[model samples]
Target: MIMVNRFSRLIGTLIDRAAALQHIASQCILCAAPGQKGLDLCLPCQLDLPALTQCCQQCALPLFDHKAYCGQCLLSTPAYQRVEAPWLYQPPIAQLISRFKYSRQYSIGKVLSNIAARRYASAYIDQKLPDLIVPIPLHWSRQTIRGFNQSEHLARYYSHHFNIPMKRFLKRCRPTAAQQMLTADQRRSNMKGAFQMCGDVAGKLVAVVDDVMTTGTTVSEASQCLLKAGATEVHIWCLARTE
Candidate 1:
């Protein structure tokens, strides 16, 4: 027992040091420019990155000037209640998300998720921190291929502020096709039945975390699994949503 305890302490110290080095409280992910206190992007990058203003509250699509719901959202309501995203899907932000997802730039996700959990959080969002944060699960095959689920890693940082539990609530029963490579219509069909709830979500509000929402297909499919498992409602929190 003594030997194991000593080894664990040593490992913990090393981890602490490593994470401290990896974390940047105020630095732009796009450019290595110094940022103001608590600012994610430096002045240049901050001003340059496109902000998605005039977005729909429920669906989170870009509105022209003074519109609420996008045309499609009015025609159809999404499964989730409200979606909050900070920025539009553009150059620098796009690159950041790609690295976090494909290139294994986990540190970027850590920072962005922290921001999402804090900035994107509302009174209801704060209230519904949920019994747990369920990351939209990736198929085992994809996990095997990519080595990690981007949403799960992103949620870890955000869950810190929300003061609620975060865990792997859903599991991929099969390896579905990648959404990136598919057409918009095909993407919807591919994600159908992609997720399964591994735990009871009944009477529980779940915060589903993801990096981006383009078609809202991926998170919706995951919500179906959670609701099927008896979840009360599913809410999505993402770093960016393209209009």
Candidate 2:
């Protein structure tokens, strides 16, 4: 029995290594050039990604000036303290995200998660890191249909990279219509009471991880739930933000 277990573990490690080597040799997903530096993205294409050059410091929305908050945020502040998104949701980045979320492209998801993790580290190197990372949960039905939650996957990457703990502390108690199809007011209405706290977060700084931030309604609702559960602060981290 011991011998068999050892052989099985060895086989699993070999398989993982082989897969990693194959991925390193694969062609670039964007330009179809040969792989370079063990990544699917070539150097030029990687540089050309739709980075969020200028954004409101509070909400991470694209901004024309160096304002801390956008006009809407000034009117009414969001529950979360700040949002950090590395890219604007547009063009090739949007297409890649769609493939990762809807098309079951796990490789693309891994690439995106890696990029987001690097960006998060650089952005917060001089600042206070969150005590815990919480992924924006999906309803059980949605999770069953999708096989996995993209937000959870991103959270795992951040957890591994930053050595921070992650918890599925938020639960989606009710499933609502897709936020993309609704107006801002409708989105807010749809998300009301949609999230519930599954674990105590009292006096802790938590970061909510999600794939994208559109109107910020979903994260706001989730943040409100966390705060109501006694969390001291909540921050939003996402791959992209739609302007």
Which candidate has the highest TM-score of all?
2
- Stretches of candidate 2 above 4 Å error? 1-26
User: Candidate 1, residues 1-243: lDDT per residue as tens digits?
Assistant: 999999999999998877665455556777777654555557677667677677897888877778877778789888888787888998778888998899997667765676566566653654545777878877777888899989888777767776778889898888887677789789988988778777878899888988899889898888888888888888888889886
Q: What is the lDDT of residue 186 in candidate 1?
A: 96
Score each candidate by Cα lDDT: 0.79, 0.90
Residues 1-243 of candidate 2 have per-residue lDDT tens digits of 999999999999999999888766866778888655556777787788899979887889999787867999899888899898999999899999989888888878877888788888898899999999999999999999988999998898899889999999999998888888898789989999999998989999999999999999999999999999999999999999999
Model 1 segments more than 4 A misplaced: 1-27, 36-44, 122-127
Winning model by lDDT = 2
Q: Looking at model 1, which ten-residue stretch has the lowest summed lDDT?
A: 120-129
What TM-score fits each model? 0.81, 0.89
